[model samples]
Target: MVKVATFFAMSVGAFAFWQTMDKIHVWIALHQDEKQERMEKEAEIRRMRAELIRENKKRESLA
Candidate 1:
């Protein structure tokens, strides 16, 4: 049927468009990006604390 062919073509085109854009991936990819960012931030906080402790120790030794 012609209608079925048209529908299929439209769906395929929509899917291709979605794949190319940086928006609206149906909440799947967004969640993953947010989770990864959270992990990196936590790691950065830990590294900063370690650096601060080392600096304090150095300052204490010099006093």
Candidate 2:
């Protein structure tokens, strides 16, 4: 019973400590990386769209 109570107290203390750590720097870094990723994704999507348009034109010609 005592070990269980102590474990619960330690767990709560660890949780409280983790909740207060500064995360703005980490968040900003992630956001910057995410922005770069989004830009790259957008470029890829545009390229795919252009390819699809070309394929559609070819199909139309075949018909």
Candidate 3:
């Protein structure tokens, strides 16, 4: 009987541990995706700023 109880307890604990780990994994994945998206947005902004500066320089040279 004690052996059966021990087995049951271990199974429950293992299930709980894996469930928590799965949630952690999902959170990490979402965090990474968000970070990637933020980086892409920053790159786009930098590109736009560079283009604007180039346009301004061309205008100044023409003047």
Candidate 4:
């Protein structure tokens, strides 16, 4: 009887631990995706700024 009760308790604990790990994995994946998207947006902004600077310099030289 004692063994059976101990087994049940361990099973429950293992299940709870598995669920917690799954949630953590999903959270990490979501944050990583968001960070990648942010990095891409920042790169695009930098590119646009560089292009604008180049164009302004060209115009100033022509004037």
Off by over 4 Å in 1: 1-25
Cα lDDT tens digits, model 3, 4-44, are 99999999999999999999999999999999999999999
lDDT tens per residue, model 2, 1-63: 999999999999988777655476678889999999999999999999999999999999999
In candidate 3, stretches whose alpha carbon ends up further than 4 angstroms from where it belongs are none
TM-score winner between candidates 1 and 2: 1
| Tens digits of lDDT, candidate 4, 17-61 | 999999999999999999999999999999999999999999999
- As for candidate 2, its clashing pairs are none
How accurate locally, in lDDT, is each candidate?
A: 0.92, 0.92, 1.00, 1.00
TM-scores of the models, in the order given: 0.56, 0.54, 0.97, 0.95
Candidate closer to the true structure by TM-score (higher is better), 1 or 4 = 4
lDDT of 1 by residue, 1-63 (tens): 999999999999999897867465657698999999999999999999999999999999999
Instruction: Please rank every candidate by TM-score, starting with the best.
Output: 3, 4, 1, 2
Per-candidate RMSD, Å = 5.2, 8.8, 0.5, 0.6
Which clashing pairs does model 3 show? none
Model 1: weakest 10-residue lDDT segment is 19-28
Return the lDDT, model 3, position 14: 100
